[model samples]
Target: MLIKSLPSTWDVEITQAVNGKEALDAYRAGKADVMFLDLTMPVMDGYEVLENIQKEGLNSFVIVVSADIQPLAQERVKKLGAMAFIKKPVNPDLIESALKQYGIAL
Candidate 1:
């Protein structure tokens, strides 16, 4: 739904993953420039994905978009190399801020 809400001019592409493994597969396949990850995904979690990405040296930027707002979780994701963390119920300002910080202007 948030993807659809983004402006068409942004020319953003999206890929769907039922779980973190698929997300990792897609990342390995060079399918994205930046990824928005949910920490509580099934099959594998975001932390696992982050670990795999770091291990494989994939060059995609990651932004965590999860309901898990715990300080430990945020710090862990940051340590794992996520570019930013955005909480759930994401607002436009936050989204824009993240994108702009990454140099992805809409």
Candidate 2:
């Protein structure tokens, strides 16, 4: 769904990770410039991933996409250095707007 949400105007290569661990590994490998992360997953959760990223001083544009819409969750991710927190069941329009708002272009 996220792949479909991306704007047609921008060209990008998409890599899908099954879980947070895989996502973090891909990021470490320099495959992820922009990551759309879920808060829940097997192996490792989104919060841990964010913490690891912060701890390692890695740089990436992280936009957290999750069903957990609690204000605390949003605030936590923000404090952990996520650029944005997007609600689950993502809308294409919102994805586009977020990208533009964060200066994430091709």
Candidate 3:
């Protein structure tokens, strides 16, 4: 539903993963340019995914989108190298801003 709401002008690709492990596997398979990650996902979670990505030196921008708005969680994701931290029920403007920060335009 969210992907459908994105502007058509944006040249983007969408891939769905049921959990972090699948996300990581897709990442390894060259399935994405930028990733929107949910921090509380089952079967590995976002932080573990970020760590694995970093350890493998994957070159992709990751933005953490989660309901966990705790400051410590935000800081932890930042330390793990997430490019942005967006709370759940995300606003389009915030998504736009995050894309712009990474020099991606719609």
Candidate 4:
């Protein structure tokens, strides 16, 4: 749903993973520039994925879009190295802003 919300003008490629482990695997295999992560997946979960990414020192920017809207959850992901935390039913404006911060022109 969030991916569909990206503007038609944004020429970005997107990949999807059903669980945290696959997300990590795809991140490594795809050379993804950005990731839209969910916190509550089976197998590894978003926190573990963030940890692994940090351990790998990967440059992919992460924008966590989860239903866990608590301030603590937001802070935790940020501390764990997510670039930004936006609530579920993600705002396209926020997504654009996050990308822009990473110097992604749109």
Candidate 5:
């Protein structure tokens, strides 16, 4: 869905992570500019990854895309440095809306 949502006018290189741990490692290596994260996963969860990123001062914008969509979860992720919180089963419209909300033109 994310791939299908990529703006035609924008060009970007994507890095895929299989799990939370790999995601963290990729960020540590400065491989990500924007991250679409899942709250639940093996090894490390999104919360822990976000915490680690904050502590390490990783310069990346995070848009959490998770199945957990409770208000508490949303608030928690926002406080933990997530720029946006989006629910799972995402679509092109949702992706575009999120980008626009964050003032991303492309």
Candidate 6:
């Protein structure tokens, strides 16, 4: 549902993943440019994914979408290389604003 809310003008391919591990696999397959990650997931959480990305030095913009809105969680993701953090349930307007703020264009 959140994926459908993204603007058509963004003109990007969307790769859906059911778990953090699958997300990482997709990233490794070159399907991730801007990743919308959920911190809670099975088979590897978003934090672990972020850690792996950092450890592997993968170059991809990550925007964490999570229900855990605590300041510490936000700060942790930033330290792990997430470019932005969006609280869930996601607001499409905020997503667009974040993209613009980061100068991401398709």
- Per-candidate TM vs. native? 0.92, 0.95, 0.92, 0.91, 0.88, 0.95
Report backbone clashes per prediction.
0, 0, 0, 0, 0, 0
Better of 1 and 2 by lDDT: 2
What local lDDT does model 1 show for residue 19?
A: 92
Model 1 lowest lDDT segment of ten: 1-10
Error of 2 at 2 (Å): 1.7
Ranking by lDDT: 6, 2, 4, 3, 1, 5
The list of candidate 5 runs beyond 4 A from truth reads none
Higher-TM-score candidate of 3 and 6: 6
lDDT (0-100) at residue 1 of candidate 5?
58
Of candidates 3 and 2, the better by lDDT = 2
Give the Å error, residue 82, model 1: 0.2
Q: Considering summed lDDT, which 10 consecutive residues are worst modelled in model 6?
A: 1-10
RMSD of 3: 1.3
Listing every candidate in turn, what is its Cα RMSD in Å to the true structure after a full C-alpha superposition?
Answer: 1.4, 1.0, 1.3, 1.2, 1.6, 1.0
Give the per-residue lDDT digits (tens) of candidate 2, residues 50-86: 9999999999689999999899999999999998888
Model 4 agreement with the true structure over 67-106: per-residue lDDT tens digits = 9988999999999999989888888888888778888866
Regions of model 2 farther than 4 Å from truth: none
TM-score of 6: 0.95
* lDDT of model 4, residue 30: 65
Model 6, span 1-106: residue lDDT tens: 7797686699888899999999999998888889999999999999999999999989969999999989999999999999899998888888998889989883
Best by lDDT: 6
Candidate 5 CA-lDDT value: 0.86
lDDT of 6: 0.92
Clashing pairs in 5: none
For each candidate in the order shown, give its overall lDDT on alpha carbons: 0.87, 0.91, 0.87, 0.88, 0.86, 0.92
